[model samples]
Target: MLKFLKQVTDYTKGAVDAARFIGQGLSVTFDHMQRRPVTVQYPYEKLIPSERYRGRIHFEFDKCISCEVCVRVCPINLPVVDWEFNKEAKKKKLKHYSIDFGVCIFCGNCVEYCPTNCLSMTEEYELAAYDRHELNYDNVALGRLPYKVTQDPMVTPLRELAYLPKGVMNPHDLPEGARRAGKLPEEILDEMKETQDGESEAASANAK
Candidate 1:
C-alpha cells in the first residue's frame, strides 16, 4: 500500500511540472504576440540611413584639379587620377579619373582629404554586378546623382530605432517630423555652452 501511494505521488508531481513548463512556454508566446515584429521585408521595405551615412563615392570632374590627393590619402592607392600638363594653361588638366569600387574600400578618407571638396560620400550602395569590371566607375559615373530611398515610390522607407521617437517600437506608419527621443548632438552642445556661460556669470557676480 505504501509503495503504491509513493508511485502515485511521484507521477502526479511529474505531471504538474510538465503542465507548468507548457504554461510557461505559452505565456512567452502570448507576451510576444502583442509585440510587433522588428524585421524589414527588404527590397520592398528599406530603412532610411542616417544623415552622415557613408556608402558610395561621388566625384566632381570639374571640381577635381587632378591633385592626386585622393590617391595619396587612400590606403590602397585606389583612385586613378589621369592628368596631362597643359603647356598653354601651365596646369595639370584632369583627363580620366576612375575609381574601382570592387577593390576600393569605402573609408571616406578620399572625400575627407580632397582639397577642392570634389569627392563626397553618397548613400547609393547598390554596386552589385556579375562582372567585377563593371564596378569601375569613371568620372561621369561617379558624378551621377545617388538614388534616395525616401524618394523611391516603390520602396517603403522606414526610420531606424535610433531615428524614431521615444517609446516607438514600430518604425512603420510614424508621423512626419517626429523628433527623436533624446537631444541631438548639436542641441546638447548648445545646452552645455549655455550652462558654462551661466556659471561664469554667477562667478563674476560673487566676485563683485
Candidate 2:
C-alpha cells in the first residue's frame, strides 16, 4: 500500500538522522583521543597563575602607617598591627605587624583598601608547612619578595586555558616562539589611549 511505503520512508529517515547525531558525538571523543595528555607534574612543573590571581599577601613594613586599615577591611580582622603612640613625634610607631595565614582568609581586602601601596597580592600559593604556627607571617616575612614560577630554572612553567595559544589546548606540546591568543594588558591600554586621542582630534576638527 502507498501508506505503508510512506511510513517506511519516514522511519528510515528518522533512523539516519539518529545515526548522524551519534556519529557527531563520537567524533569529539575520537578527536580528543588523538591529542596528548595534559597532566602537569608537581614540584618539577607548575602552571603560571593568571595576571589577576589573588594568592599570598605581600606587605611593606615602612609604608604601613599602623592605621589598622588592613585589620578593619579584613572580614576576620586577622592583621595584628602592634604600634605605640610616639609622644614626641605624635604618630603611631609600628612595632611589629603579623598576619596568621592559618586563620586569615585570602580575601585580598587588606591589599585593596590599603592607604599606602604597601600591601600587594603575590602569586605564591605554596604555603604548606609542617606546623600551623609556621604559617604566621610577621612584617619581615611578609615583606620578602615571592619567587616567580615563570623565572624559575628548575621548574617548567606551563600555560593553561586563556594563556594557551589559539585553538591549541595542549600546553605540553607548545611550539617554540608561539604567542598567546589575546592581546597583552599594555596593548589593550595603548588601544584605549589611541581611541581617546582620535575622538578628541575629531571633536577639535568639528569645533574648528
Candidate 3:
C-alpha cells in the first residue's frame, strides 16, 4: 500500500509539471501573435543592398580594334567579332559584332580581356525579354567611340600624337610622322600633361 501511494504522488507531480510547460509554451506563442509581423511586400518596396554587384556588360565599339580579344576570352564565346572592307578608306573595318545575352554568365572576362577598352560592365540589371534573341546586341550598332586624346607639342621632340582608346592594344604605336600631322590646342595639351603626370605617378608608386 505504501509503494502504490508513492507511485501515485510521483505521477501527480509529473502531470503538474507537464501542465506548467504547456502554459509557458502557450504564453510564448501568444506573445508572438500579438506583435507586428516582419514580412515585406516585395515589388512595392525593395531593400537596399551592398555594392560588389556584377551587372550587365556594355560595349564601346569605336574603341574596339577587332583584335578578337573579348571574343577569345569569353568562355561561352558569346561575343561575335566580324569585319569587312571599308571601301571608302580602302581599309578593313568592323562589320558585325554581337553578343547573345541569354548565354552570358556575367563573368566580366570579356570586359577585362578587351584590349581596346571597348567593353565595360554596367549597373543596369533589369534584363528581361520575351524572346531570347532580343538580348543580343549588334557590334557596329553598339560600339561607340570613347574619349579623345591630344598629344604634347613641346615635349618628346616628336609631333603631337593621339593615343589609342583605353582597351585597345595596338600592334604598333601610331607612326611618329602621323603624330606630327595635327597641332594640339592648349586645352588638349593640358589634358595630355595631366595624363602624363598621372602615368608617371602610377609608375613611381608601383616601383616603390
Candidate 4:
C-alpha cells in the first residue's frame, strides 16, 4: 500500500510540473503576441545594410590605370579588359573594361587585387532584369561614381594601403605584431585619414 501511495504522489508531482511548464510557455507566447510586429514590407520599406555589405561593383575611371590586375584576379573570368599600347605615349590606354554580373560571384577578389583602388563594391543590390544580356556593364556604365560611398571599417587596411599608390597590400601583408594586437599602426591610421580627406575634397569638387 505504501509503494502504491508513493507512486501516486510522484505521478501527481510530475503532472503539476508539466502543467507549470506549459503555463510558462503559454505566458511567453501571449506576451510576444502583444508586441508590435518587426516584419519589413518589401519595395516600400528596406532595412539598412551592415557596414561590410558587398553589392554591385563600381569602377572609377579616373583612378584606374588599366593595370589589368582586376581581370587577372577574377575567379570566374568575368572581368574583361581591352587595352592597347600607345607606342608614342609609351603607355597603355584602356579601350574597354567590362564586367558581367550574371557570372560574377561577388567574391571581391577583383576589388582587393586592384592596385589603384579604382574598383569597389557599392551597396546597390536591386539588380533584377528581364533580359540577362542587360546585366553586362562596360566601362562607360561601370565608371560612374556612386552618389554615396560607404566607408566600411572592415576595409580600413585597404584604405591605409592607398598611401602607396603603386603598391597593393592584402590581409596577409600585415605584420605579425599588428596582426596579433588587432590594431592598425599609427602610420596606417594617418594614411587612412589622408585618403578620406582627399576623397571628401574630390567629392565636393564633383558636387560643384
Candidate 5:
C-alpha cells in the first residue's frame, strides 16, 4: 500500500509539470499572434540596401590603368584583362576587359585590389538570368553604372571620369609605326625630362 501511494504521488507531479510547460508554450504563441506580420511584398516593395552591402561590381574605365591588380587578386580569376604596351605612345592599353559573372563569387577582391579605386560594388543584387551566357559582362557593360547607384553620394564624385568617351583613341590600338625603334618614344622622354626638371627645381627651392 505504501509503494502504490508513492507511485501515484510521482505521477501526479509529472502531470502537473507537463501541463505547466504546455501552458507556457501556448502563452508564447498567443503573444506572437498579436504582433503585426513582417512579410514584404516582392517585385513591388523593395528594401533599401545598407552602405556596406556587396552586390554587382562596377568598373570605372577611365580610372582603370590596366594595372591588373584586380585580376591578380580575384579568388576565381573572373576578371580577364588583355593589354599590351604601346611602344610609340608609351602607354598601356586594354585589348579586352571582361568578367564572367556566372563564375564570379562577388568576393570583392577585385574591387579591393584596384589601385586606382576604379572598381566598386553597387546595391543591385537581382542578378538572375535565363541564359548563363548573358551573365558575362565586358568592359562596356561593366562601365555602365546603375541608375540607383548614380544617386549614391559616394559614387557621384567619380561620375565624370567613370566612363571613357567612345571614340577615344587607345594607344595600343594605333597602327604600328614604320620604324621599330628600341628607344622610348620622344613624347615619353620629354615628359620624363619635364618631371625630373620639376623635381630638381622643387629640391633647390626647398634647399634655399
Candidate 6:
C-alpha cells in the first residue's frame, strides 16, 4: 500500500513540474509580447547586412584570363564560360559568360578561383523579377577591360618548368621568362605575395 502511495506522489510531482515548465514558457511569451518588435518595415526601412553576407555575384570580364576557373569552382556550375576564336580579329572573343542565378548556392568558390581577382561578391540583394530565367546573364555586359592600364605584378611567367599537378600556378610567383613582358606595379606584387603566404600558412595549419 505504501509503495502504491509513493508511486502516485512521484507521478503527481512529475505532472506539477511539467505544468510549471509550461507556465514559465507562457510567461516568457507574454514578456516578449510586451516589448517593442524588432522587425524592419520591408521596402521602407533599410537594414545593413553583415560583412560575410553573400548577395549578387559580379564578374570583371577584362581581368578574366578566360581560364574558366569560375565555372569549375561553383558548387552548382551556375556560370557558363564560353569563347570562340575570331579568325579576322586574330583573338579569341568570349562568346558567352552565362550565370544562372536561379541555381547558384552562393558558396563563393568562383571568387576564390579567379586568377585575376575579377570575380567578386556585391551587396545588392533586391533582385526581384517576374521570371526565374531573367536571372541568367551574359557576363560581357558588366564592363570592358583596360579602362586604365593598371599593371598586375604578381603573375609568374609561362616557363617550361616541371609539372605542378595540384593547385593554381600563381603567375606572379613564376619566373620572369614565363610571365608577360611588361612593367607591373610593385604594390600589386607585394599584395599578391602576402595573400599567397597567408593562404599557405592557413592551408598548412588546416592539414595538421
Best-fitting candidate, scored by lDDT: 1
Q: Candidate 1 clashing pairs? A: none
For model 1, how does the per-residue alpha-carbon lDDT over 1-208 read when each residue is reduced to its tens digit?
9999999999999999999999999999999999967989999999888878888899899998998989999999999999999999999999999999999989899999999999999888788999999999999999998889999999999897888898888988888899987899999999999999999999999999
lDDT of 6 by residue, 1-208 (tens): 9999999999999999999999999999999887644554444333434345576777777667677778777777668878887799887777667777777877889888888898777655665679988777667533323211113233222221122222333322333334333334686899899999999999999999
lDDT of 6 at 150: 19
Every model's TM-score: 0.78, 0.80, 0.47, 0.55, 0.55, 0.51
- Kindly provide the TM-score of model 5 when superposed on the true structure, using C-alpha atoms: 0.55
- Candidate 3 structure quality by residue, lDDT tens digits, 21-75: 9999999999988764444343332222213345666677667777887877889
lDDT of each: 0.92, 0.91, 0.64, 0.72, 0.72, 0.64
Model 3, residue pairs in steric clash: 61-143, 61-144, 83-95, 97-139, 115-167, 115-168, 116-167, 116-168, 117-167
- The parts of candidate 5 lying over 4 Å away from their true place are 1-36, 149-208
TM-score of 4: 0.55
Could you give candidate 2's per-residue lDDT for residues 1-208 as a string of tens digits?
A: 9999999999999999999999999999999899866789988999889888788889889899999999999999999999999999999999999999998888889998999979999999899999999999999999999879999999999886778878888878577788888998899999999999999999999999
The digit string of per-residue lDDT tens for model 5 on 94-118 reads 7778887899998899998788998
Better of 1 and 4 by lDDT: 1
Deviation in Å, model 6, residue 78 alpha carbon: 2.2
| 1 versus 3: better TM-score goes to | 1
Worst 10 residues of 6 by lDDT: 156-165
Candidate order (TM-score): 2, 1, 5, 4, 6, 3
Candidates 2 and 6 compared by TM-score, better number: 2
